[model samples]
Target: MNANPKILLYILMISALGINTPLSIVGIISQIAEYFNTSIAISGLYVSSFTFTIAICGLFIPVLFSKYNRKRTFVSILTVFAISNIAIIFTKSIYIASFFRILSAIFYPAFISIALTVCEEIAPKGEEQDYITKILLGISIGSIVGLPITTGLGTIFNYQVAMSWIFAINLLSLILIIIFFPKIKGKAKSYEMPFSSLKSKEFLLATIGIMMMPIGASIVYNYQPYFLQVVSHVYTYKLSIFLFIYGLFSIFGTWLGGKLIAKRDKATILIFQLICGGVFVLLYLFANYLIPVLILILIFGILDGMGYNLIQYIESSVIPDSPELANGVFLSILNGGIALGIAIGGFLVDGFGIMSIFIFGALFLLLAFIILYYIIGIMKMPLKYS
Candidate 1:
């Protein structure tokens, strides 16, 4: 794949975008809280808002880009994403920071959708999944690199300084994307509308799967620091160490996910992985000691990463001809679930206690599993709905 200049450039740019944004910032949530003199829960809202925009913008991006020039559309989105990160660096108030975050989130889904489409457009027809997986690996790398970079930067400079570092990285990455991505000779056939496919059973099921997996994943992620501080009595430095370990091992899980999809059906992998995800959420809830918490989170991240990739693969499978729209819708539902999970988990943490957040996440995922199972079973029936 390195022999292909476009593919190499695509991976580099996407990896920077993915790594430099959310995961990097998540490692600094407490630092953000300290900087703004706000509660950590409120600081968590910055991450949640990023997810909210990604979800809400899913419905409009495909339609908006359908009529726009692909290269300009992508370049514009990347510019917006980079500029918003700059806005984030300068904002003093948490609310203002969150506002910029939401703005940044708007352009993200569009860029991601376009990137996947670009991969497909470049691939040798039958190898779409291969290209798509390699592209998605950027997200995996982001999760890996973002954590360490955030922690290391935070250790040296303040949270705002760390945010600035990520922004600079994004600016450099966007420049690279502008330089290397090939220009389209004319409007591609991919610009066609894809709204009709939203109603398909497979598409709908894949959407639900994407939504639920994050609910389960975020329950743990949202409260991980609290889990370490309160349950494990681990200090901030130790917590960062555990987080680094989680990021490191998760690369294997992500790789495993791509390998699994290459060997089997996407829907089957998503269903099984989601069920395991729920189980991991429950395990995380009950974990109290430092060792158990560390072990479970590592397990959780690995499983969640695998489940996340499978969810995307399933969505790509739903509308194989339109991976752009399918991936957009997939990202939208997934982000919605993430926001919902954080909000719901916050409520549970306050009302029922920290462990209850895990219960709530597990329940939401179980609900998704049941819904998809019924939907899949019904789709096998003789009668068909249009």
Candidate 2:
């Protein structure tokens, strides 16, 4: 398929904005709880259910859609996403809203898998990682810029307004995609199944490592607004600003991940996991101090950003033959980790306190560090970087 690389990149980014809109709502989760007259932990299911659906559906969605036109599949998924957001905006019941959320999520893995494959196809030889970084910038932008703005709207207005903003973004992405996205051919009929890659011991070990890091990070990140409010006593108005700053620094971290992986490879992820684990501990240790908490947020934000690219590279590297299936599995496991973390975080919040989430986050990261170290340092499984 003939297309402008830059334009394709922008389309991918915009689509990412739509795909990641559910995450942006994390800032307004409390408002959602209030709207539905539900507990905070119950409200968290909105996020977790969506992610869990992605986790389950991501495993097969890519392979199922692998034979269709990429342009059509992406546009169709965005349409469904836009419709789902509309449904969420009008729904008064949380259960109804969550149903739509899951519906949209069912298609998310397919879109992500296609986007990753397109990036690989368009990239110049040896610059695939750089292209992937640029693509991930869309996700970072959605998190930092789009997330804060929508969250502010929700805080100032209502959660429905936030849902409306998501709808608008998806609408915009849909229009842009229909206008500019080129038709890319799908995979050949005779191709390897996505599950085939899982047979390798190295892929399984690497997948475990990737899954652990997100589970660790999600425990804190999914409930960050709560953490800031309860532990640090951050004012309501300033919460959006803090989230924005965290997301902005995360963009820099994404860029840094692209550069670091070239030189350090698996070592970069290991060090990042270690630093992130320590950062979580510090967050728990100095929860009452605003300045120190803010500092740790910055540090964690950078590492979180780095995790996106570094982990994506690792997943793709381990199973190079089936890019669509590989990426699909990556998205599945990533969201699976997020769902698990949210569940664990909610449990901690209800049983112990919000502060306990960080402690658990640190422990999960420690496990991730060990698994990654074994795979790269001891097992000596070869990643492209290694």
Residues 159-259 of candidate 1 have per-residue lDDT tens digits of 87788777776777667657765554324444566567767766676577557777867776778778678767877777777777776677677767766
lDDT of 2 by residue, 287-345 (tens): 88889899999999999889888778888888888788878888887778878887889
The deviation in Å at residue 230 for candidate 1 is 2.8
Q: Where does candidate 2 clash, by residue pair?
A: none
Give the runs in model 1 whose Cα sits over 4 Å from its true position.
Answer: 1-6, 9-23, 29-47, 67-69, 90-100, 185-195, 266-271, 274-278, 281-293, 377-386
Pairs that clash in candidate 1? none
User: For all the candidates, what are their Cα RMSDs to the real structure?
Assistant: 4.2, 2.6
- Which portions of model 2 miss their true places by more than 4 Å? 30-43, 91-96, 190-196, 284-289, 349-355
TM-score computed on alpha carbons, candidate 1: 0.82
TM-score per prediction, in order, is: 0.82, 0.90
